[model samples]
Target: MRQEITSYLSTIKNEMYQLTKFLYDNPEESFKEKKAQDYITKLLLDKGFTVLKNYMDIPTAFHAQIGEGHPKICFICEYDGDIKKGHIYGNNLSTSISITAAISLAKVVSKISGSVIVIGTPGELNGGSKITMCKQGAFEDIDAILISKPHIYNIENPKCPAILPLKIVFEDNLSGNLTSMDAYIMTINLLCQLAKGFKPGCTIENFSISDKVCVISLKAPSFDTAAEIRHQIEILTNTLGELIGLNHEVTLAELPCAEIKTCKTLNRLFAHNLKECGIIELETDKCVTSGSTLGCISNTIPCVNSYISILKDKSIPYPSSEFAKETLSEYAQEIGLKAAQALAFTGLDLMEKQNLIIEAKSELIVQSN
Candidate 1:
């Protein structure tokens, strides 16, 4: 069955590349991905799957489900690329790989039982739609969620640290005499002091966005710690506002403290599939603390965010590099194909191997306990 799946995917490889090219050539911003959504929904619909638009009441989001019955699986696709330009981190490539894998599994659904869902999550550049969907129970019934991201190595199960996104503004103009530069300097000084215990090289630290306004974030081992830090910062901000003769307001967006609790069985399966494709998994490839919307989905369900290295310059990995001009580059195509083939193999395993699914569920239960 695995061989058959591989052979089938080989036949449609060109189609996948074409879709990747189309999305790369025409990029869209978050919540404004009508054309991208149209293409994705049409592909899934053409494959006889049921595609639901306005997912979670978000106009740009979508949920496409195929097959039926138990052991339902999901694929996460960030169809929204970089704002104004084409795919910078090769997100369009990731989307294409995910779409092709889901559709490939759909074609073989008769031989294997279970279901597949391709979730169109937008706003990856901002606070992503995945968080909203997870909060609203979008992944409530999914057994596993698969993600393909760019990296310099192949990671089995990555862990993301607890993070808080915060923004504070000084409103009262009683200090109407205060210039933007003055406000910035004053707020930055207060923020620097308030960022106690959050220093560079520490598990908990302040990652401030340098601008006229004081926008910052706190990362900690747990969400509670992050929240507490935010509270302290707010109190300090209020005190600073009073001293500076300005009123202030602070906004905080807190995420789950839970790590991307990985299912070992699924990770092992993915590693095996990747090795089959000449991709080596190393023990030194440790989980790094990075921020991604995948954090929300993994917190909600058994999900794995695997990174496939596609480094042409050796300096720019998938998360930070722009490939708009390299849409048809050989390096980009290679990465896209590897991502699609590996993910498709894993999807096939999830569908056909009941014992594997049982093992994955057991691992999740044990870890959760």
Candidate 2:
């Protein structure tokens, strides 16, 4: 069966590259990825599968189901390419790989015996696609999810910490206060002091000035700030939380940050899975990724986010035009196929066990200062 699926993919390899070139030639943003979605749909329908256009009620978003069985599983793919001029990271290539994988999974997983869903989501750059699907109950029945990102590294252990994104304003010109600047300065000092134990698990803690100091927007004066409080450990995450909560009792302008959560599961997987995946979108080669911001790893589902790693840059393993120009060897394609192979094997194993019904839960806590 594996050989059969591989044969089917080989037959379509030229078409896959053609889709890549077409999408690369015409880049589109989220919600507007018509050409990309159309091309992918065409491929799936051609393979004796049913394609659901706009499955999540989100335009350009879809879910393709193949085979049938007890546990319904889904793999994730995003096709919206980057249009920010020079920095194009293989949206077309990854999408092509993901769709190719999906087509193979469809051909292999017998619907009469097992079920599968290929989720082509848009707007990952805006950070809301999968979450939106979850809200619509798409995840409730899903046994597991698969996703991948461009990378120079591989999946390590728990990586890409959860983050809290906050929009805050400080003002002292109201009825009771010292001054916004003074409050800001004092809060900065206290937060920094508390941030020492807050470093690793709660690895990313940064602030930036946002809007102009206009209170009229308020008449007197006020400051706009945003916080990206990111952490990996729950305890370290709460350290800053404790400080923020303690200060909130004293003044309202101490400020809060963005969607922050210390993803312990994510962090642990970061250390465990680096041998599996890497986020080349951050830095190609030189495997030792740093910083766990929501900006880094949020929508990445359950266990896979744990697999991120840093790659050795002794070779330029990026998807840039420059890298594509160097076809002097054959390892990168092999590695990419390795990703597909792993996904297939994991998915097959999941399908094999889809009928087993069991329930269990546990909590493990670790502390670091």
Candidate 3:
């Protein structure tokens, strides 16, 4: 079965490459990936998967599926690009890999008693589309979720921190003396001081600031810690406003993202498949974290969000023009194909073995608690 999967993916490598190149050539931003959505859905439809466009009331999102019954494996596809760097984060490669895996798995799903679902989740850069879909129960029936990302090294089970983005507004109502910038600076100082005492690993960044408002992000190892941090920040902001004679408002900038709960059962399966695909040197020592919306889905279902190295040079930082260019290179195409093969292999394993899904779900239950 593995050999058959490999041979089948090898034949469709060109098609996968074409999809990646097309997405690279025409990059689209979050929630505006019309071209990408149309192209991918059309391709999936042509491949005989029953596709539901405009999934969960999101125009750019779609759900494509094949086969039926237990152990329904889901492949998440994120094609939204960065606003400035355009596919610099390798979303094009990730989407292509997901589509390739789903299509390849569909070829053999008839022989098994499982299903394969390809979910087109857009707005990963800004809108948190997956989070919205989770609220809408998009992944209610999924047994396991698999996604691969392009990175500087091949990694398994990277830590993704729970993130909370907020907009803080300071209004000088009494004396009109305290400017918003002053409030922002003061808040930053307080947050820095507070962070020193936080037990859980956390980070706070002020991403955007204007005359009257500043947008800050909080990341923590878990949602409980993140919410605690938010609570502390709110109290501090209110105290500071009172002391400075200013009015303040704190609002959520986006949906709060949950930390990834990687299923050990799934990770082991994916690692075995990755090694079978000739990826021997896996990086598991370094601690890596991402603010991806996929973390939201992983919080509920068993998931494996692995990484495939797209750049040979480790110094080229991600979300840069150079990294974006590397995503279009032949090396990236090869890596993407391998990742797809590994994902499909893992999906096949889950389909053929119900015990694996049961173990993965049990792991998820324990980890999520």
| TM-scores of the candidates in the order shown | 0.86, 0.64, 0.96
Error of 3 at 149 (Å): 0.6
lDDT string for model 2 (1-369, tens) is: 656666776676666557656766777886788887888888778877788988778889887888775555566777775675311445565565566667777777764366767878776544446656665666666555555544545643323333343333443355444555554555456555555654344432445444412110000000111122221222332443344332221212221212222334433332322234332332222222332222222232232332222133537655455443221113444444445545554455556544321110011112111
User: Model 3 compared with the native: what TM-score?
Assistant: 0.96
Best by lDDT: 3
For every candidate in turn, the CA RMSD to the true structure comes to 3.2, 9.2, 1.6
Select the stronger candidate by TM-score from 1 and 3: 3
Cα lDDT for residue 315, model 3? 99
Residue 264, model 3, lDDT: 82
Question: What are the per-residue Cα lDDT tens digits for candidate 1 across 308-337?
Answer: 666666555345435455545677667667
Cα lDDT tens digits, model 3, 1-369, are 778778888899889989998998888988999999999999999999999999999999999999888879999999988766779888988999999999999989988888899999988888569988998899999999999999998888887788899889887666577777888889888888988988757888756777677888888888889888889989999999888888888899879888787788988899989998887778763456667687778867889888889887889997777888888888889888889999999999999888998988888788757
Q: What lDDT does the true structure give each of the candidates?
A: 0.72, 0.48, 0.87
Model 2 segments more than 4 A misplaced: 85-89, 156-158, 171-193, 204-206, 213-331, 353-369
Residue 325 miss distance in model 1 (angstroms):
4.0
Once fitted onto the true fold, the runs of candidate 1 whose alpha carbons sit more than 4 angstroms away are 173-184, 193-196, 199-213, 253-259, 281-290, 317-327, 365-369
- Per-residue error for 53 in candidate 1, Å, reads 1.7
